[model samples]
Target: MQFDRKDKNDATLLDLYTQLLYPRMVEEKMLILLRQGRIGKWFSGIGQEAIAVGSALAMKETEYILPMHRNLGVFTARDIPLKKLMAQWQGKISGFTKGRDRSFHFGTQEYKIIGMISHLGPQMAIADGIALADLIADKKQATLVFTGEGATSEGDFHEAINVASVWNLPVIFLIENNGYGLSTPINEQFKCKDLVDRAAGYGIEGVQIDGNNILEVYDTLSDLAEKMRKDPKPVLVECLTFRMRGHEEASGTKYVPQELFDLWAQKDPVKCFEEYLLEQRILTPESIAEIKADFKAGIEQEVEAAFLEEEPVADTATEMQDMYAPHPYQPVEPNQQSAEIRYIDAITDALKIGMQKHNNLVLMGQDIAEYGGAFKITDGFVDLFGKARVRNTPICESAIVGAGLGLSINGYKAVVEMQFADFVTCGFNQIVNNLAKTHYRWGEKADVVVRMPTGAGTGAGPFHSQSNEAWFTKTPGLKIVYPAFPFDAKGLLLSAIEDPNPVLFFEHKYLYRSLSGQVPIGEYTLEIGKANLIKEGEQLSIITYGLGVHWALSYLDEHPEINATLLDLRSLQPWDKEAVAAAVKKTGRVLILHEDTLSSGFGAELSAWIAEHCFEQLDAPVMRCASSDTAIPMSKVLEESFLAKSRLKESIDKLMAY
Candidate 1:
């Protein structure tokens, strides 16, 4: 049954049958293990093996493939070691994600495969990003992404496809029409006759084929992949198939119609392909029996080896080791020669420096290219870096953020600008779930910088003005920095760009043109996790960040005899706890300040930390100065009343008096 080099070249019948049968046999063995309670769960791809196997075999190994839970054949056809894959399913330490994730939820860079997240459609945009990286490098590589018919209804699917079509990226959107998404039927999933018909809405080529037929899937994808490498463009392919088994073994198939099951049973891909191979003399009944015996024996051996491997232990050191990629603090002092620039101009200078230094760095946001962004921060960037590097993206924040993660996966850095900080809620999932967890989940570097234009003093309404740093501060694996002065703004931004993890840079919109300082004309990066002591004193400590730092300095300037120390914590996630503790110990009384709502603000966390760590050193109880709990108002008078400035002086006076 072994094929020689000559047979491998022309014996498509034998080659495909082996490829298709491998996953089928592997899944059959896995089901046995599942029943024995050896593995936790399994997403059975028993009936639709041909789709994954054929597609994977036809594509080039250098190209990238993004697969979902049901695409087990894709892994098997790529010849991933069965022992390691079984170890992954068994939650062993030898697994790709080291038991952090289960099933096909992890990707391996060596295999050029990026795994899908539970949120179905985001991988589509990620594929667009991978293809974009290749297009930018002028490499003839195409990316293939998979999704279910049900996921096509998601906004991510539409946004990703539209972007791919408009940009002409070399991506193939493969929809495995498996009839049911969990329990929901196709009738409820979409109204169109076929999923491929939706491709026309995105203005792309569309095709539908019998997914059960391995020959058809292989032939069609191979041609399309070649064409894409030579001439990059997006294409949608719908593989018409059925889920012969329950979604998972635990989920019974009782909800499906018996007649539908009976009809699909007759067209079983494995049985149909076997008949064709037998009729063409490509495989004899005895030869098939021999192959099955060989496959079973090999699979059982691998499974046994995987079971003997050690399970992942939940040790504190192991758990916290890779929460974020290691980024050591490297401080570059500001140059002696400097020029006074606004906060917005400092941000622009930092970006220009980063772009000039790293050729693979890319900038993406709405109206960022020609219109120069809403705040004109990137006004002349497109002319300097060209449209490919300084690109304007659609208003779909979720997709763009996911695309940034994709770009990072391919060794390219991306900076995504959110016009208004409050609008980041639209991309919350990608930021917290995907970008923040990429490194901890699978050891993938998420070198993405999200520039958030934040704060609220412009009377720009509640929607436009919000201090939402607390939202991301709660999420682990993200670095948050809010700089008040132009010097700090330029330096911290440059450091964030180089950090090998996701960093959120919050720029106060009110200080964009209002605040100016002597910034270093050349490249420089300040330490991210260090606190800056703007003013030093004795009796009390005023701890704050962003615009609050400015407020505290002004308050201290107004009362020179107050004798209070001011500490500006530029970074939130890895705040300078050592500096804050030292300052609190020096000054018996401490006051925490922020523009966010008083209830459950970041100040609360700082107060709790101070109370826990610096409690014995304090002469008075920890105090907090923050805005009211109500939403920011549109009217200037209401906004003035809503902000924390009105209460800042009172809180500081009370603290110093204590």
Candidate 2:
């Protein structure tokens, strides 16, 4: 019951007790505010305060901690200003997320804390990325990530732990076995005897402790953290505890047995720790009373001041500022004199140039390090960049993508490749929720380029041959790039890497080997959100991107007298609106084309925009040519019919005649 470390004197014990008491008092006050409707809601960590406070105190000052919604003590233990904390919870302008999000959904780099996303599982993989940075830099710092026993069933938890173990990253997977997840008990969540037992499957050490015992939790994690710093390896520590309140205030605790609360009240973390301090003579009754009274007063004053501060206004003027890190677009000068190369080689050349130019640039994917990826785009990159920068990850899309976000958080540029573009579904949550939302939510840069080799070809069938660009185009925080030529592929990839946003670079697998064009070697970047006018004319405008551009060019070559404008839109999200408007104004008719399915495709958005804005200038209704609404087939003949490239020529003729 007593921590008798000679080095950690009576003063250290008293300080730990103070740290534990602060969040308890803060939660008590916040609960009152919640009842009064002064704040929206709170995820109270009243009885389980010891796990957060003890583990946070055990960590070195510079180390990072990823805390779940219930771990408010982690923030208070690190001494994040109570004023700002209250503002964040109250949705005030002075909060860390600037009132964009609320209730521990934000993180601050100044305190080395990465806040948890609502998914409850992706943060584990993100912690691997933070620890991977330390491993690469040879830093003696370990990261601690908190999770609930219920979340262990999430695939990200398994993927993250497997990756950390394989890479020997210094991470502490802290699982708080809080007895229930929402209303479901432990038995319904998993079949294992204890959650820590699952760690053995990951080939890592596992430990379980009484989560309510502040002295035990602190000592166990402190020793483990020290060992990890010296010899980096992951460890799973399961802390047995109970959630004393409802999942949220509105959820209520009626489902929890009153007898269970009665039993847990006798072993409340705060009361037991306070009792321990008094019994050990670390502090007298008067000092404990003063500490509690002072903490209560501090919480009250800070909350009142936070309420007095200005609330966030919905201003459209500054709304777009932080959506992406500032990187001005630079126009590309087409270098015809450069040597000819295949599209895949151009991508290879760009990645080579990127690694050489940016010292902190890293590549992560399955089999990328030694096997050079499935497409062999990074054939010899492992030799040039070494294993530290070129990482081969497990077949866990969610974890690797989240790790890339983590690296970006730690001030590095990462390029994460999906072995096949279709495989991106496995990691979709990290992309749409974590990576895409990071900057807009908490002002965290997601400087990552997700290389997606997309499109239907090579008889690869539905799974591997998907033109999935439309999937991410609808997500706001992402930038989509789909180039049609070798020169553009090399230039735009370099540009995507330089842009401080989450860019989905979709490379057409069909064009990799089949298409060859003059590419300027070495470092060059093309402007994103700009369309390249391949050939300009006045009769009709053929608006397309990716493989559709190639199809349009071939048709135009055969019919030289059509007098049509061909626009290859490289960026899908910020498609060249000015260029599109100009093309629509110059040519009275428009034909939208793409390789993706016709329904809800990117072309639908373009066609609707053209119909809405250029209705007055139009000579006829906007036409569209795309694949039919069916999965890409394996047979080459079926795929060609599905793609309907022949329809592009017919659509052009109809638009021209109109």
Candidate 3:
């Protein structure tokens, strides 16, 4: 062997041993805290330290790593001080997230480490996108993203790998197959003979290695990282290991068989490496005793000191700012009244204005680069900004959103497009669970705008056309915007881009090219949670948004005698409740209209709120005009007849009579 393992002073072997020892000590200390009730819980990396250390050591100090909860050993290897980790786990104010987050849910970008979400698979796509960002900047670096055997079953895992392969992203998928998925054995979960074999399906390299062998893992990954840096290719390496302890501090090994646990105990990675060091005569008994004593003393002192840190105080004054983005409706530049521009053109101009204003802006979507997006709303954008800024991604909505999240967190504001509004279903987890909760969880800025080309009136079938704005309104931390006019679309989109939190910008497909108004070409922004009363009247108020606003306007113009108030609710979430309340209070009759299915549409929420607050003032019942809860038809006739204009007019007449 080139490097003699028999030698007492082998630098690589000694370094590897030291790197793997930190997590073991931390794990042991965490259990002590748990027993004393100082710490609530901890996910032990008892048997997987070699996997964590080896994978993290594959990269340089400048490179980034997105670690799973079990990959605690990397923090010590990468030089994030043990004191900070203790403080974070103890939920102290000195923690990375200021005690707002718990367990492995906190990270520091200065150390080039990203913490894991409870849903671990989503970070794979996020890491891939981070790699793309570095690749675009010519960083010549590879990102290490970790996951377990169970996460491979997630659609996010498959989608991320496929997209990375398609783009040839420089990322390493380090899979620690611990022979169980939280007590469900691998045999019951996966049918494949070897999980590594699935790598060929994506046209990438795959290998299985001895996860318990510290020297073997470190040497293998060191070479692989060099090769990947030279040539960007995604690789999946599955490590065969076994969990020595239960899934977490709360979970026990009751489900694990006695024989299996005993079998893995013999091959415990830490003990095996320790025995190797002893056999090689790397240190005398006195030296080994000194190292052990040092680790034990430091663990106790650091943990005790961490307890002295104060708990984070609740800052209710910033609660409103933390939950949503800054509503920067105060415009800096003035605008002149220009002739009508297409809705699609207005969206493109808004993006241009945003990118010109802010240097750290990126765009991601499928067929967005050369094809100018599916709708060509981004036509000629790549030429203006280059391929690096305007990215053409794979047909993985989850990856696009996840990557946007990674970019947004790392100082760059991102705008991700869902080619079709219905396809947002593919990325719902990233949107609803991950993106929506960032600000609420740790006060992290989810500064990304998801442009959803929504609504149906073009005879497109159900799969391509959908009004999903109502679905996300249920989430607290998200801001939803659906613009009715080209003017609102331009202004609100710029505001969405500049906001500090995630914004869902829904642009109606029916209005993309067909709808136009006297929109200004310069930069201006409308308030996020405000509504415009297009027409005021004494009889009743027709509260509508998007296409409903236009339809109601046409009907109201034809019947001036009706004398109704029409409101354009551009901002869907955090809606203009004060304006709505006053209008409903004055008229005493309310008709909520939308193009979504009548039941549980966003209008239902509006009606429910009105009933709760303004019921006594209302003269009659709150009525809704919308389509039936049926799949959209392909035929134009059926679609039009099904989405009837007469319904809105008739609903209005009946409400007036009542």
Clashing pairs for model 2 are: none
Candidate 1 lowest-lDDT run of ten: 1-10
- Candidate 1, residue 542: Cα displacement in angstroms equals 1.0
Error of 1 at 180 (Å): 0.8
Runs in model 1 lying further than 4 Å from the true structure = 1-10
Global Cα lDDT for candidate 2: 0.90
Q: TM-score for each prediction?
A: 0.98, 0.98, 0.93
Tens-digit per-residue lDDT, 1-658, candidate 3 = 1223533357777777778887888898788878888778888889888888987887888888888878887888888777888888877888886776787786567888877788879989888878877777677888888889999999889988998898788888889999888989998878998888889999999988888887667767777778888998999989988887888868888998899878888888878887777777875567667877888998888888888989888788665556664454566453776768988888999999998888779999998888999999888888888888998887889988998887776668899999988999999989997788777666567888999998888889888767889889998789999999988899889888888788999999999888877878688887788999999898999999998898899998888788888899999887999999988987999999998887788999999999999999899999998887788787888787666354888898899889
- Which residue runs does candidate 2 get wrong by more than 4 Å? 1-7, 330-337
Better of 1 and 3 by TM-score: 1
Report the lDDT tens digits of candidate 1 across residue range 320-431.
Answer: 7688998777777778899989999999999999999999999999999999999999998888999999999988898888888888887799999998999899889889
Q: Model 1 compared with the native: what TM-score?
A: 0.98
